[model samples]
Target chain A: MSQKQIAGVTIDVNDEGYMTNHAQWNRDVAAALAKEEGIDLTEGHWKVLDFIDKDFKEKSAVPGMRRMNKVGGIETKELYSLFPNGPIKKATKIAGYPKPVSCV
Target chain B: MPDDDEIKKVSIIVSRGSLEGVYPGLIMANGARMKGIDANLFFTFFGLHAIVKKKMNNIKIGTVGNPALCVPTPMGVGMPTWLGAIPGMSWIATAMMKKEMEKIDIPPVGEFVEMIHDAGGKIYACKATVDMFKLAPQDFCPQVDKVLTVGEFYEMSAGAQIIFT
Candidate 1:
């Protein structure tokens, strides 16, 4: 773990730039991190990030693509369009969750 | 300079009919998309079963001539080849394998292919195989994008890594 300043606050982050402490994550930090990914948090983007955050807090695990489609009410293609490239990994990072574990 | 050696795309070929044989290609294709890489899955020979609307989900595990087939016990002894040849042995093995895959959240073959497609991965059927099997377009799963000859596949997969599973 390493300390990095995000959104004007010192925070602990992993080597991959994911926030290590969930408590330190906020909308500003998420937006700042998303900027590094070349993403401007739009309404669609926020919907996914918020769903991931809620899912992590309630289920205590990162939601995979299927759960994001079936339970989280986001279409697979829409998720891809929202995050582009690596949706699950990118979304999880912005949502303050660890890398996703499930493949499907 | 950007890393020229980085893998920007992958084309995986699935040529086997067994359940285990089909999944590696699917997983790889999906995983490529997950990495923001372009990916394609080409189904040929026996692998066509994986795209056949009727047979995709009913695929069975390879039981015969496979040294890897084993019984779940303390000893972990491998199943004898002769025993593997027995009828219903493959069914039993397939059932157990599907159970384990489910425990880990691996979706069924049909659903898996759809997931890969939904992620923008292309799925193709080999022209030669389709001709040999006398398969019509309607015989394939809905997610299959096209039927292409080897030359056509190579044309599209240019500058991409090709993996035969």
Candidate 2:
């Protein structure tokens, strides 16, 4: 774990720059992280991030493509469009969650 | 594509039909796509069963001669080779494997194909195998993008790492 200053706040992050402590996550932090990934958070993007954050609290784990597609009402292709590369990795990082395991 | 140190593409040849044989290639191709790498799954021979419309959902484990069926037993002992020949062993083994995979959120073969395709990975069927088996285009699952000849397969694999599984 390491510390990083994002949006003028010291936040704990992992080697991959994923926020380790979810408590430090806020809109400012999320926007800062998204900016670093060259993403501008839109309403669609927040829908995914909110679903992930809420689902993480409920399941205590990161959600994968299947869950997002089936339950989160997000299509797989839409996820790719939103996050570009690997949606799970980028979404988890911006949402203050851990890297998702390749579950599905 | 950006000129970088990262591997940009991979062409995975899945040549076996057995559950164990097929998952490695599927997982690897999926992993590659998760890394933003271009991945292509070329199914040849019995591996075509993974892309066959009917057979894809019913992939079986070979219980009779599989020496490495190391799945858990009810008694926590290794599977005996002789026990594999028993009637219904393959079915039992398939059920156990499916249960275990489901527990970890791993999808069945058909859904796995859809997932990879949805994530922008390509799926292909070998033309020689399809012709040898007298299969047609409609026999393959919908996610398969093409049935490619050897020349076409080679052409598609250019500049991509070829891994035969």
Candidate 3:
């Protein structure tokens, strides 16, 4: 366990930097996390994040990338461009959701 | 810092045709593409069966002599190898696996390949295997981009992370 402070707020995070407490999330935290990943939060990024958050609450796991593109209403290429290191990993982590158990 | 944002690519080699052996490459390649990374898959040896039009979707699960078979269930208990070796068990096991994948919204083989292709992942056949098997272009599913020699595969995969499954 570790603590990370961003935008003057403290949150608990796992060693991998994923927030351990989902309830601590706010838009400011998302923006700060995205900035750390070298991303500038945009409407497109928010769209995917919003989908991830909503899906996590409803389905208990963020939809895989194909579903995110097809059902979550974002194009595959656009998702990559938004969270370039690894789209699903980066976006869900920033969205304040637990990392997917099956994703590598 | 600039290097952190550089787009990455991966090249995967699929060398077996068993349902267990084949799907990892498909899933990983698809995952990479969904993340916006370029992915190339090279199917060789028995792995060609994964792309073979008539056989791709019909590949069976390996039950006999397989030590790693785990029947995922609520109890978390695994199927013993002896049980797996029983007559007709492979078919039953395959059906169970397919049903489980469907529960998680994972697509079948043919549809999985199409989704990967639609996401811009490139699938290829190994030239040697295609020649050894005397397979023609039409023998493969439409999603396979081309058949390539080992040298060509290495050339295309230059600087990309390469994985064998």
> How should the candidates be ordered by TM-score, best one leading?
1, 2, 3
TM-score for candidate 2? 0.93
Give the top-scoring candidate (DockQ). 1
For all candidates, state DockQ relative to the true structure: 0.71, 0.62, 0.23
Q: Which prediction has more favorable DockQ, 1 or 3?
A: 1
lDDT (C-alpha) at residue B55 in model 1: 96
What does the lDDT come to for candidate 3?
0.85
After superposing candidate 3, which stretches have Cα over 4 Å from the reference? A66-75, B1-10, B28-39, B63-90, B115-121, B159-163
In model 1, the Cα lDDT at residue B142 comes to 95
**How many pairs collide in each candidate, listed in order?**
0, 0, 0
TM-score of chain A of 2: 0.96
Per lDDT, the best of the predicted structures is: 1
TM-score of each: 0.93, 0.93, 0.75
Residue pairs in candidate 2 whose N, alpha carbon or C atoms collide under 3 angstroms = none
TM (B chain), model 2: 0.92
**Could you give the CAPRI-style class of model 3?**
acceptable
- The lDDT per prediction is 0.90, 0.89, 0.85
Q: Give the range where candidate 1 chain B is weakest over 10 consecutive residues by summed lDDT.
A: B67-76
